[model samples]
Target: MPEADGAGEQVGVGPWSGGSPPDDPRYDPELLAHGDRRNVVDRYRYWTVEAIRADLDARRPPDRHLHVAIENWAHDLNIGSVVRTANAFNAAGVHIVGRRRWNRRGAMVTDRYLHLHHHPDPAAFAAWAAHADDGARLPVVGVDNVPGSVPLEGRELPARCVLLLGQESSGLTPEAQAACDVVVHITQHGSTRSLNAGAAAAVAMHSWALQHA
Candidate 1:
């Protein structure tokens, strides 16, 4: 296995474009027919769908952390973007709460590397997380810039916690907010009501890594 930098990170492929005609039977037909081209690294290009799935399954970490997104209504274009960010961060898993369908355009096919779980609602995600770990019951942390949110920079983050993100526009639902053990805020200088859901998730995940990767 190739090692990442001291920061516990690995670099993706560059200067490689999606090649190899998808005429091969092993690759995902959907991806082949559609434009799978994106800024993604070269390692994934033209790879068989089953091959990629198997590879991802083998690479999954047993002790890795979790990240969740509350889809709520059909307004989660940020979900795919968040998934892409999660892939860049190499999160243990991604939990999607609410609508099953999301905009894959933003994911840019990085979803191939992520282990995704689905929860019907926020309450369901909370319940699963509560018992997901034997005694630990992975801590649920919400990321938002709301008025009462705690500063993420100074706070201690859990090693195996689940970072929860709300929908792109509405933010977290009441049920999701109530389920979080702590609500964290990402400090910003620019005047805005809130940050983009995908951007917020990336910042939160990186913050967690800085504290306790």
Candidate 2:
């Protein structure tokens, strides 16, 4: 860079000049091409999307997965929080069952790396999971505090499975409730009837990531 001197002569700019590109590798070129103000960590400052995905693909273990599923009964705010949480956990994908559109405000730009899928109903989610791993038969795990549920800590989660979460006020519906191969619950010490949908989704996703990822 250069600067103009008093006599209009070109002077070289000093090193103190505040202009430098980011050094992170995960940053997408598309983002850089546009400006590179993404919400990703510093490690992914200025890079191309293809470059980041290629790097992750090379380093990620084949069996490591963090799948998050949310039942969008009426487009709740918890859905956005859940998506953000799944992104934090580096989930393999996000399954949204219900309304085709969801609020992206709470995602905080994390949705870029997180894969999202839409399903009209629980059956559709199940169908995708059934053939998830090239027809290898993956389990669809559900999270709820129902009587017949299992403790997430005591069991191991599969790498390629759907972890389903119900709506906020009303948990999973009859059909949705019965579609789980296994249901897990988060231990609550308070008088609340159950945990918030977003909180429960985070806990379940973390537990599953610990076991499988």
Candidate 3:
């Protein structure tokens, strides 16, 4: 694993060496020659960006049920981190409600590998979920510590559902809370009032994966 520099930025590795190019169509010629240190797994090293995407798409389980969504009303920097986590978990896709443009620095370029959807607001997102072709309605599960939220532990997160999170400063908006099928809160032992949106998103996604992945 590469170490982060003093500024907390990872130094990328250089190109591969001591070998001739393999004949696999999946490998990117430039990456093979230059080396590939992208945040991808070893299985994807030196693979073309499109090839990786196509392979993941083809191999992805048909029942990929967990979708992650973020309320992006404030251009929240945490949105990028949530995107990165979604990619890590191989989520079906990410939905950004509100601002379309978000800071991608925290994504570390992983957004190129993940499916992203945009909605003008929560209502549009809710409408889409309500109409999903699945026999059961896809639930919009909200993550927050707001009053009346159920504890997340042992809660049966639906297999076909979207995990919704709010912005960094403010939690879910009243409209968003109203839109959720159920709001669940992560149990915390420390003094902090709540987890940041990105961390909350990761925990929520992992919870779903634990139940249904």
Stretches > 4 Å off in candidate 1: 1-64, 134-136
lDDT of 2 by residue, 1-213 (tens): 122334656433222223554455654434554444445554554555556556555655767665788888786888888988987777777888988888876775566667789999988877787788767767778888887888887788887777889889888766777778988888878899999998898888888767766
| Model 3 lDDT-worst window of ten | 1-10
Instruction: List where candidate 2 sits over 4 angstroms from the true fold.
Output: 1-35
Candidate 1 lands at a TM-score of: 0.73
Tens-digit lDDT track for model 3 on 32-55? 776676777778878887888887
For each candidate in turn, the TM-score is 0.73, 0.80, 0.89
Steric overlap count per candidate: 0, 7, 3
lDDT score, candidate 2, position 77: 82
Candidate 2 CA-lDDT value: 0.73
**How far in Å is the alpha carbon of 158 misplaced in model 1?**
0.7
Among all candidates shown, the one with the greatest lDDT? 3
lDDT of 2 at 16: 20
User: Judged by TM-score, which candidate is best?
Assistant: 3
